[model samples]
Target: MARTVRFHEIGGPEVMRLEDLETGEPGPGEVRIRVEAIGVNRAEALFRSGEYIEPVKRLPARLGAEAAGVVEAVGPGVSGFAKGQPVSSVPAFSQNDYGVYAERAIVPAAALLRRPDGVDAVSGAAVWMPYLTAYGALVEVGGMRAGDVVALNAASSGVGLAAIHTANRVGATPIAVTRTRAKRERLLEEGAAEVIVSDEEDVPVRLLALTGGRGAEYAFDAVAGPGVTDLARAVAPGGTLLLYGALSGRPTPYPGFDLGMPALNVRTYTVLETTRDPGRLRRAEAFVVSGLRAGVFRAVVDRLFPLEDVVGAHRHMESGARFGKIVVTVTG
Candidate 1:
């Protein structure tokens, strides 16, 4: 039997229970992996609390989508993978269909990526989701180019830091926005050209002044609420505002009409748009792999928790005090 994390009811981190479960064989197009590390994300917290975009389809549901481990077995019709090979699982599958928070777990083959040499379990587990989301939205879909300026919020989170690196890699400038000064220096050290303290200063005004009144070419917003209106004011003419997350837990309103309807374009995006597509995923993988090999990218982990302390890990993530990814390590 494998120790797996599951929730019987929708609630806080206290509701999650690590119970012994049968480690079953993989079905068709699936692979069973011996998980070594799991990446904790806000999505898991939202899922457990019944506030995610995708609802809990049934009771006693599993709770993770990102992990790094060694392959133990492959189901029928699966190729390009073998037993004992190192691999990392990305957030490419639905949590309702599968989860990786277990000593042994079965995940779809499509979600597996061969972990590169020199990448340990914690680094592998922490890299994919955040990098893919930033690279896919900014580089692949947004067509971000050199000399462009991108304003992104949630600067201390994993994805936010990745966005800073991605922008710098492409010769663009990344302006990071956070709620307080506690994380300003760290954000600057992470390659952000400028850090905007949203609570201390006016975001749109700072963005406008920094861009010499042209505004940023793109505003990548994670917290979507009434703040979209303020961010809209900082978008250059014909620029796009990409809303990729809803961390605000409130309603969001389109700001075009409210701001006199300037020549602005607004759109929503998610990493799934790239991960779910074969062509896009391939391109993104190549780009990120090149960056990693060249030392242009790195995984930033804030804290590590043992498998038995998954509840404490979730509590830390919800505390809003972390600066990077929270990883959970599994042991025999």
Candidate 2:
């Protein structure tokens, strides 16, 4: 029996329970793994709180989308993976279909990526989601290029720090925005060209001045709400504003109409757009692997929790006190 995490009802971190269940054999197109580490993300917290974009479809629902493990079994028609091979699961499948928050879990074969040599379980669990989100949104979708200026908010989170690294890798100048000043130096150390403390400075004005009044070529926002209007105002003419999250938990408005319909392109992106597409997934994996090999990409884990402490992990994530990825390690 595997100790898996599930919730009978939707609510907060305390709602989750680690219970033993029969981990059955993998069916067709499925792969069963002995999970070594699990990546905790804001999306999982939002899902547990019943505020996610996708609603819970049934009771006693499972939780988790990203994890690292060693394959123990592969069902019929699975050709590439073999037993004992190390792999990492990405957020390519729905949480309702498969979850990795367990000692042993069955996930879709398509979501599995071979853990690169020298990548530890903790790094494997933490790397894929954040780097994929940053690369997919900025490089593949945003078409970010050398000499471009990209401003990103939530600068200390895993994805936010990954954006800073990605921007530097592509020769783009990254400006990080945070709600407080405590993380400014850390963000600069992570390759952000500038750090804007939103509470202390005029973000739009500072962004404009930083870019010589032309504004940033791209603004990648994780917090989407009324404040997007101010962010939109800081995007250069003909530039794009990419919204990937709703951390603000408020309604987001399209600022084009409010800003006199300037030549700003406002768009929304999700890592699923890349991870769910075979072609995009292949390209993204290659890009991330190259960056990793070059030492340009690194997983920053802020804390570690045992599988039994999953509730505490979720609480920490929800508290907004973590600066990087939070990983839960499974031990026998």
Query: Which 10 consecutive residues of model 1 have the lowest summed lDDT?
Result: 269-278
Off by over 4 Å in 2: none
Provide the overall lDDT of each model, using Cα atoms, as 2-decimal numbers.
0.94, 0.95
Kindly list the per-residue Cα lDDT of model 1 for residues 1-332, writing each as its tens digit: 99999999999999999999998999999999999999999889999999998999999999999999999999999999999999999888888999999999999999899999888999999998899999999999899999999999998999999999999999999999999999999999999999999999999999999999999999999999999999999999999899989989789999999999899999898878988898998898888888899998988999999999999999999898999899999998
226-303 per-residue lDDT for model 2 (tens digits):
999999999999999999999999999989999999999999999899999999999999999999999999999999
Instruction: Please report, as a residue range, the 10-residue window in candidate 2 with the lowest summed lDDT.
Output: 91-100
Error of 2 at 204 (Å): 0.4
* Pairs clashing within candidate 2: none
**Each model's Cα RMSD:** 0.7, 0.6
Q: In candidate 2, residue 307 scores what lDDT?
A: 93
